[model samples]
Each structure stands twice: as C-alpha cells, then as structure tokens.
Target: MLIDRTHRPWLIFSGAGLAVAAIGYVMYSAMVVGGPRGGSAVGLTYGIIGYAFMLFAGLIGLRKKYPIVRVGRATTWMRGHLWLGLLSFPLILFHAAFSLGAGSLTRALMVLFIVVIISGIFGAVLQHFLPRLLTERVQLETVYEQIDSVRGQLLEEAEKLVADLRSALEGDLSFAEEKQRAMAASAGTVGGLTFASGLGASEFTSQIVADFFDQQLRPFLLHSGGHHCALADKGQASGMFSQLRVQLPRNFWPKLADLESLCDEKRGLDRQRRMHHVLHGWLFVHIPISYALLLLAAVHAVFALRY
Candidate 1:
C-alpha cells in the first residue's frame, strides 16, 4: 500500500515481463502477412496472458474478502494486484493490435478496461501519498468508524471542564475541588496545563464563558453542526479564543486552553474523516466497473472462441 522498498521486486519483475512481451509483440507483428490479427495464434496468446493477469489482479478483492483464508501473504497479493494489473493494460493493447475494437462488445470491454486501469492508477497514487499526508495532518486520528463516538466523548469532556471552571469562578471551592480532582484523575493534564486547586474568579466571567461555550463551542461540537460554525476554521477559532481569554480572569485561562485543545482535537478528527473518504472514494468507481469489465471480458472471450 505504501509503495516502499518491498515493491521493488514486483516492480522489477513487471518491468522485465512487459519488456519481453513488447518485444514478442513487435516481432510477431512484423512477421505477420498483413498485421497481427486478434484471431492469430500469437495475438490469442497475448489476449490469454493479459486476461490471466487481469484475473489475478481481480482476485486481490477475493483475497481481501477472505483474509482469514491464507492463500498467500496479503502484501504479495497486493503487490501482484498493483503491478500485474498495470501490466495487463499494455498487454491488452498488444492483443488488440493497438486498435479500439471494431465490434460493440469488444469496444465496450476496451472502454471498461481503460476506466479500470485509470481508476486503479488513481487509487494507487492516493494510497502511496495520502497515508503520509494523513499521518502528518491528523495527530489525534482514531478509527474512522469511531469518529462520531469520539466526538461525543470530546463534547462530554468539554462540558465537564466548563462546569468545573464555572464552579471555580463562582467561589464554590468544595465543588470545584471535587471536580478538579475528578478532572485530574481522568484527563491528568490538558494542553500542558495541570489541574490545580481552584482559583476563584467573578460569577460574571463564569457566565460569559458559559455563554461563549453555548453559542459557539457547543454548536461546533454537536453531531449535526455544519462547517459554517466559526470555530470550524483554525485561525478564526484561535482569534475567538484569544478574545475570550482577554475577557476572562487569568486563572480561567487553563480551562479555556483545555477547551481550545478539545476543539483542535475535534478539528483533527474532522480532517481525518474527510481524508479517509478521499482515500477510499475511488473504490466506489473502480470496483463495480472492474467487476463489469471482467464479466464482459469473459463474454468476449467466449464469443471469440465460439464464433
């Protein structure tokens, strides 16, 4: 998937095989009476070999589907799928004598093959680079399916932090101490700020913090919240939090910093979701079309043999 050094052997083998096939096709074309026709023995051999490569490539899906059944190493199958799949295209062209088929079924198969190859290449490129990009961008990445659940947890955590801060600001030392202890036990430290003994601030500042969280941060954390929320943008969120910090007492800054960290984590999750979609989205187009191509190719092969 990463297209690293492990791919080297497959790449070398594929390149060598392609070169040999190209050479054979060239010699066969030159020696043929008119041109290398698909019905010719050499051309038929080319088609068979190309189709075999395609079948092997398509079986990678089956390999994935039944991963528990160890036919071979998955990495081997994947490498074969990527390299042999690519090799099939040029071999298929050689089989067709570099012409789009004159018949409707063959033409359709050719078109479908083209689509599959292009989509496969696109997917390969994405797999090669998007993983590294995802790693660099999403530090708090979680399981893709668990993103919603994690977001819910983050919301709860933010709410608890806000309540603790509010209690501290309102001079409820006992409640704030209990909450801070709970926070320390659960989260330890947030954004490098340790949970300390509650520092008292004005009830007015607590109300403003509560109002800001409800109006801006809470909506941004909600499941149905759209990207139109101001906190969705990093610079805008930073500026808003900066302004909120100016209004609040210095003691409340740690809780606010924790809130900002939570928001940043949420943003990272959102980014991971989008990138995950992009990473696999090509399969929606590639897979179904590939199956169709394989089916039509079978039909074409049968028709060629019979008629």
Candidate 2:
C-alpha cells in the first residue's frame, strides 16, 4: 500500500498506510497470539518503534527556524512521524493488551508509553495550529530594515535641502544685510530666494515640511507646488518617499509614522522557532527521565520478585 503520497495525498497516505499496518498486525496476532514464544518479542518491538518515532518527531521540530536551513525539507519526515505514530499507537496498545496480570515493571512501561504518546500528541496539535494563526496576524508587517530603508532615503533628501538652506542664510546673506533684503529672502520661492536675508533658508527643518507630508506626498507637492515653499516650511520629500510608501500597504501608512512599531512582523518566525525548541527540548528532558523511570521500574520488579 505504498502509494504516491501526493494528489489527495494526506487522505490516501493515512488511509492506505493504516490499512496496510492493520492487515499486518492482524496477520501477526492471528499467527502467534496463542503461542507463548512471541509475546515478549512483540512487546519489545512495540517499545522500540514507539520510542524511535517519538524521537523522530522531536528531531524534526528541533530544526525549525534554523537560519541557514530555511526549508528543513520537513514535509516527508513529518509525514513519516505521523504515520509512524499511528502505527506505534496500535503496537503499544497490543503490547499492553496481551500482558494482563503482568509485573510492576510491565505496568510502569505501559504507563511510560501512554505518557509519551499523550505529550507527543499535545505537541503535534500546537505545532500545527499556532504557526498558521501567527502568520495571518502578522501578514501586514515586515522587517525593520525595509522601513529603515525609507527613513534613510528621507534623511538623505532632508540633508540636501539643509545644505541649500545653509548657502542662502550664511554664505551670501549675513547680519550686515538690510532688513528689506532679509524679508525678501525669507519670502520663499520655487528655485529659492536670491535676496540677501540674514535669516535665510538655512532655518529649514523637518517641522517645516511636516504638514505637507501626506500619503501621496509627491502629488500633494505637485498640486500645491505654487504655495509649496511659501505655505509649508521645507515642502514634501522626493519620489524617494513615494517609493518607500508603495512598498507597504495603506494601513502601513499610519504605522509608517514610526517604524519601530513593526515588531509584529517577526512574531510568526519567532513563535515557530520557540515551539520547535520546546518540542525538541523535551527529548533532552525525556531521555534522562526515561532512563530514570526504567531504572525505578526495574527496582520495583526486583523487589516484587524477592518478596
């Protein structure tokens, strides 16, 4: 029943895989259930496959969000984890079912298998659901550098304007200039003022351009070009501003007022990485803990035998 695990894939894969496994188990159970020779062997096989598959799922989750390894090629290994878990479920149940009135060690081993299965199932649900939800909430957001790219462009344009402002206020015009010339230079012009105003354009600042800066900045400047210099202090930023605005959505505009608020952008990636760590890390917890449980179960068995 090893069909192509694509094209209505999950349905076919799970169904066929389960069918094949069920058939194999039925054949084995019927062939040997009455015999005493194979019971221990079946239990041991169940314990090995169950532990191995639980370990594999944890390993796959551990690799999540690794920087250099983007995809992790996790799809099939994950599917294997699912199929193997389903397969192991029956194996462990059968192992337990046939061992009625077994020793304390046997009961402890069964309890351990049950605990591992429940924990692994809980982890599977969390890994599947939380990531998709996180991605949707953060769809509008992006990396800080993308927005920083905008602020960088704006600051470059602002610096150029400041240089132009400096020449008019300080280079040609000075405190010696007459009051009339100073007033005229301050009057504001399209190509900029020629008047020798002492307090010339060098006073240009972000506050001056603040009002004219709209969502469609260049158009607002072009349409209001006549009064652009006179009405607002410095006028709108260049097409550079438009480029950055277009990179983001309309809702991003209000958020655009400050880029630091874009922290939600990285949340999805972080959540996946975190869950991966938690799931995988449990094995580090589980291996040592399982050894201890096995040891304790063995001790209990030895005491029961001695008694």
> Residue 185 of model 1: what lDDT?
41
Clashing pairs in 1: none
lDDT of 2 by residue, 137-185 (tens): 4454334335434434444543444334333434343422354244554
Q: When superposed on Cα atoms, how far off is each prediction in RMSD? A: 4.6, 13.2
lDDT of 1 by residue, 253-302 (tens): 87788999999999998899889889999999999999999989999999
lDDT of each: 0.85, 0.46
lDDT of 1: 0.85
Query: Which regions of candidate 1 deviate over 4 angstroms?
Result: 171-175, 179-204, 224-226
Q: Weakest 10 consecutive residues, lDDT, candidate 1? A: 191-200
- In the predicted model 2, the residue pairs found to clash are 182-197
Model 2 TM-score, all chains together:
0.39
Best by TM-score: 1
